[model samples]
Target: MIKDMQDLRKLAYNRQLVSNNRLVLPEQVSALESYRVLEKPIYELIIDDLKTTSWTVDELSRRYGIAKEDIREPLLIAMRDPVLVAEGFVPRRVGRAQRNGKGSNVQYTLLPIPIEARIFDITLGLSLLHFDTLLVQHVDQLQFIPHDEGLDAFREIVAEYWSIRGDKVDQFISKQDVNCVLSALGPLFIPNDGGIYDRIRNKLFEEEKLLVPRFTRKKINKDIKKIRRKFSEGFFDLTDVHSTVIALSDLTRFCKYSNRMSEHAELLKISEDFFYSLFIQVHETVPVPASDADALTNDISEVSIGAGQSGTRDKEGTTAMSWEAPKCPVDGTIAEFYTVITSETAKITEKQNALRCLRKHLHAPGVFDLAICSLTTSANTNIQKEAIKLLAQLGDERAVEPLINVYGRVGATLSVEVIHALGSIGSHEAVPFLLEVLDQKRFENRIAAIKALGQIRDPRAVPVLIRCLLEPKGEIQRCATIALGDIGDTVAGPALIKLLHNPRSVIRVEAIRALVKLKYTEAIPVLQQLLGGDRSKAVRDEAVRSLKSLSMV
Candidate 1:
């Protein structure tokens, strides 16, 4: 890694003199001046040691005969500084098992600068030096062209300086080259764009081939069948799942564009099932949201296979397959429902109906396990929600950990469902995770977690709910009040009673109801006062009801 101003200057000088190319810009050099840590001997030593492989702070300290405390801060600063990252000096932080095998130590490993970033650096440098015309003229001759993030930046810079339209540049570049560059960039190139850039980037995404390259229609057809067979046999590798799905999608598009859809009827059926299977596998294995998975499946189908074209093609190319529900067993046993639910070929609605039917057999052998699988694996939000409701209805204590795991990994809507399930299950084991959710800043999640905590009726949540009652937001205070009542912890009685005088009558009403549920007769006198003198009729009505209950108790 280039560690100091001198090294950077030497690099730029050599590139300009020997290669006749300016690879580093003057601004980049100036930016390095602000990061004085680069000039430190320790920083240089650390970079050198990390160049060949990764090393822990302890290992580095031992190698350099310096105190660990002395080098840790500078090392950390270098690891995180954006200037270093942009300039390609920063090392990646990785973890390795400790000598004792207890945990892992953070190890710093130097990585070569990504080719895309390098391309950007070189293109920017050349453009700054008034070589834009030469760069544009010889673009095809350059061994490495920009792609992905660098491609966008390179296009922008070339367009701005060279005055060449981006579309014109695209004509000069082959699709195969673009696919090669994109594949080399890997899935790590996450796009964050807005305005015109967003539109352009999205158009590019739609037009460019995925990591999977195009093959002859014959080869594509063969590969699709092979992939489908592998999926059916449960022998498909999860690591290649994304590429395989994209390849199938590309094949579908090829069939459409080549007017070979009639010849590839089996491809359409296999593609539909394959997409659904991949959706389930993606949800189960990754933390992707249900909506995103839905979009992925929909986008592929709409762009490649065309929507509502899953059946046999008529002479006019309309679907000929009639919609029908899967046949249920005559006995309607739990095994039958499980079979329908777990079947890859079953429609989403059919599987969801199966899950709903399993509600009657909530405690049946293997039912809880099936629900857990659906909760974690089903890509359809409705099905996942149904499974969550079933799990909650089952009230199996063993369901707590799985629910908590799903809660942590899923999107907000499903997370709310998981919270409700945890509360309904009423397992003390879920209390800590629920309490953690309460501490989060998301209003919807916090509110859902609060209500769930109330349903759980865990005493440990009482103090936290009481604290939540003090929050300035009326919705939180109201939910906390109702939750305190559900918990029926006498310890929360005083806090609930205090809300009687709150400015918002809704809070006062909730407090009255909570007090009545807690049977806190001590609030009877206050309730009597509110019943007669409160300004709001709702508060007074609730106060009277509370008083009657408390008095009877």
Candidate 2:
């Protein structure tokens, strides 16, 4: 509900929680402005709900008027970018594929897209779009497991979509579309197996495999009949029967739990049978590879294992077999380091090494926890700097006090990064250091500090910021002014108004901006004075622009 920039800034400075001020980071702000095409619309659609809860693929798809499949690709890409997620943007998966042995289908969760990555996605939209094209073009490269004539079904779809004669599957479909078909077809072959469904889904997306069931003719016919019934009822909405079969073949997932009623079972069976017929029809219509004889060989080698064989060992000390462990060919330590850094799926030893490396690299004290306390003293300058940088990445508040204590130990780069990191950490302890930095004479350090405070959006910064606004330096005054605007405090309105008549055009302009950000109706008199009576036309123009922005807000 922050209605304007001033309110945003004030909340950032006054809030007990610390957070990054994206407005201060030119790169972030610039990126956000550029990426507006992609993020603005998506954000408007999901922002409200994302603040409080996660959205399922189906729900978001329904609400946004997009295919669930289409929604996931961007959602996944956004989630991988933390800056976007921090801004109250997020995506979530809907249903679980029934479990078998492998895993569940890939589902995307919704989250905020941070300013940094948002820029990249927007700037590189076209190039990334081509990646989908390439994926479809090279679909043949992916491997698939043969199930329920799954392999055949996959080939049929690929040939129909990508073969020399058939229609090209150029239109970008979403992961959700495929997911829907898989969910509906679950009852026929496998009742509730998420794992099996995932494997099948992967094969389909990757254009590798199918999920054909191994059963008697009668059973197969029954399942086919059920699937067909669903298809006729517009379950899949396919124009060509072959496309429907290809979809069903990929949709086949394992069912672990059964529906209590035979009627449900019968319905699933019919859906499957219907799908089988459609799949074959599509297969016949498509231009199959010239040599159909090789179909048998395709099936035979589908399950072949890669080279590199055996070892036997177990804690029992029997003839225990040792299987090959998955290892990266690069530095083993790097792998360990990543495991530690990710903190998602790694062992304790890897994490320790990661922490050790981070501690060694603590030159710029920031937020990522590169500092280590050896129980002696805290001013271990080098270690502390790296620790602060790492802490910024970690975004943990626990590092705040220690960071404030280490503030004076580093140079400009480290200080700037640390200030921002502290903002990101959103800790109240940082306010003191931020205030101290604002008191410093140098513009760079002072500006960084002011910007950090603004990002934190803590109201406590208002008085200190108000004091800075009284200073004469245009740079400091401008930073403080913008910080005030971003902070969005009406309390600073009077101080900001005082700047409107200052001799410096820059200060006058910034003051106008601050007032607009604060959205102080009382400032209409001051802005009008500046716009009509100011000596500089540029200053007057700037004031008018601020008025326009405020009006829009």
Candidate 3:
């Protein structure tokens, strides 16, 4: 038996015939990684046979049906460093281990490999989202029945983006192509047949209804549930899922797939049952309301801020509730502060600075719409942005409705800022608008929406934020990880633990941090595993910190 290095050297090399060439160790095998071999069923059986308990060589042979010689190297592995063997093993170093026959009932225990291993992870290298995007386009391109302008415009949008990036439309997309799409989209795009797919369908439909003749909405809608379910099953053959459902896609489903969505019930938002997917349609024009001139002028007289000496102050407690001490760029008191912000001929910089000053100074709060209206309507882009920030800082529940109204009306940049402020304000009233922003395309905006939901830390948002983990973009996943932690709800515990197994170390680290903040006891075992088996020092240290925190709690 290979009890030591000398014994291993005496063993013959395992051989395989490859196209008339005898493939030898270190030649065909050196190109492979240790994790590759560990991910297979053979490793699973080996781990199950030897893990947590050691067995004599003769017993191992009886259990796994391996020859005595074959069991030698495995036995050597079980003794010296059983925990890491599943990651990869080299027969050269035997390390110090009890001899197979040194004692009766010699035992070996195998530790399971973490899915997020630095190497040898074959499972879902990238989120399924990456592959789904390409498949969606391929299916759309193959749709001959609806050769209308909407589909044409959608194709043009894809082609234009590829052309802009110098990527070719005809270029064959490889298995790795899915990851590229996810990177471009930001972290993850969770595919739920009910919400996202139907939204994609409507996005295509909306383009046809608004742009081309209303009569052009003549196409029949296909089964999104069937399409999504098939993709969920890892069906990559487009033809297999009934007309391109899985067509050339299904690399990895974003987030971990489960038999029961109930496990993550906390991640689902209210009214998301039939909501439209974010960023599905390829519409060129978003049709933002034509300038804010008319709306602002009509509301000025009715919208005076600081109308009352006893106006309500913001209820304090939440993170976004605190206000800075009032400052005056123009000079002395509240009156002067109000005058400069209200002045028409003031330089944009002065007005912006004045608004910034009033954000803290303007304490009177009944119907502050006049100030908010002035800022939102200001022709200068800088003034508008400053106004949005000031309104959010105003720290009143009333700001919710007005912000929600102007959500999509402003330009994209201002829209995202508004969304951020809504989250900062922390009100239930803002949830619907925030949910709307999440459902729309434009991941950058979606990210802002996510941060806002996290800031609010509302239980209603747990499920929605959980879904963000499935997005293909690692940064998005990182942000979601931070957000989940900020909420500090235990219901999200399992979802966060699942991320520890994600392939990306950065993401895995973020997940660990969030799990720590949540104080989830259930993660103890997983954290212990990472603490012992993780390859990266940073990850291992993070696991240690989390474990320490959990124990203290």
Candidate 4:
């Protein structure tokens, strides 16, 4: 059971958990856990009712036939919220005592929540699907309001939600969390549902009604501004910065591949350049590592990791990178540890430390091959994990088969890590084995497997991941949708378009992302229907995005 708002707020106010660095709520242990308390159907009812209007505690209980105690927590939750506090007010019973000793004493009326409150209610009620819908439902009303507070609030929500590094948002966890938001917003062209285009047109392109205003440049500039504001907010910290960078890197690719950047190529290029320098500067200013190891950005070992090819080249024919062997570090400690790892006298801790040294100092083939051999011989799980991480970062295809052979023999925890390594390696050679894992693996392992397959960008994996869409697990299905999008395979286009009708809003939203990724212009008519006609506002917003992704092209 979750705590009510007052208790949670009181705890935060008292600085109990606030002593720690990040001031996260108790519920948001993970990004995915945001709004997770609203998973109950009863909470949905309360939110829906609030969205339609607002209700006092007594009225909510009476109207829904639910006890106030039962509804109290969820309702407070809807109000307490994602950064900003809950809106709307419970009217104090003006006169609980009898008036003139006659008939009624007081009335308990619930005033409607402010616009920001409605946005929060819908967002908490819906999940990841709310960003686009929140705007569509309220943009028209925003114009009527006095200031940019509502628009600014919308921007903040977008930054908060998209900036998260979560499974539902990205197929692979980003090496950098910031990049996750970057990637999600990259190819993303959110259809301005409530005539935002009309408003922009009426404002900027008003004089020339006959001509299409060539608004792509304006859109790109707007994106740059929004991203810059998000940066100023400084959403990341040292702990999760890598994940943030990975997501941002993915966004750069996202803009590149979807070719929605066809018109806005400068956006991706400038962002990558700006963020690369900014990250390096921030990286320098941060605390030193426990060991005297090199900073991650300065490490040359990553040079070959994304080598070979980056999915399919966009129309720009982006340059392909060549892999080169890493030079052996001069320290000589790496070679000493490598030799000692297989020695009979070596303890498990020694071997684990050796693997760690190897990861830090050498990416040469001879030493890397030795790491995989440890997987079979070393019973120590810690040793195995370091070896896996080293081999994955080695960016060698040979590491794929050995990792696959060891995957099943290992425990579930290590197996998931193994699959993640395979994905990082980003080799097509791992696709077949990973697809098999999707079929044979259990729980998180299956999701990891699909994620790896997607990163490899092999066409063969497209249909297999699509088949995963039918699986009973909604989690897997969502993973499959994102995987298909990552592959960017044209073959997945029709299949994803078909999912537009899926009753599940998350699935439908993911399908739109996949279709946009594939750039299947053929789906435009269908998307228009959903944009104008879908029952779920969230799903409709996704449709608008898909349409925008194409129309902009």
**What RMSD does each model have against the real structure?**
25.2, 26.5, 19.9, 25.0
Compared with the true structure, what per-residue lDDT tens digits does model 1 show for residues 242-336?
23443444455556666776745666676544433322232233444554333222211111222222335556432233212333334446778
Q: For this target, which candidate reaches the highest lDDT against the unseen true structure?
A: 1
lDDT of 3 at 525: 94
Best-to-worst ranking by TM-score: 4, 3, 1, 2
lDDT for 7 (candidate 1):
51
- Model 3 clash tally, residue pairs: 30
State the lDDT at 434 in candidate 3.
69
> Least accurate stretch of 10 residues (summed lDDT) in model 4?
179-188
Report the lDDT tens digits of candidate 2 across residue range 261-368. 443455445443443332222212222232321221122111111232243444532221222333332444344443444444543223333545553443433213
Considering TM-score, which of the candidate structures 2 and 3 is the better prediction for this target? 3
Q: Using Cα atoms with residue i matched to residue i, what is each candidate's TM-score against the true structure?
A: 0.41, 0.34, 0.43, 0.44
lDDT pick, better of 1 and 3: 1
Candidate 3: give its CA RMSD in angstroms.
19.9
Model 4's TM-score against the true structure? 0.44
Q: Distance (Å) between predicted and true CA of 342, model 4?
A: 4.1
- Model 2 lDDT at residue 37: 17
Those runs of model 3 whose alpha carbons end farther than 4 Å from true positions after fitting are 1-332, 360-370
Candidate 3 lDDT at 371 equals 50
Candidate 1 wrongly placed segments (more than 4 Å) = 1-332
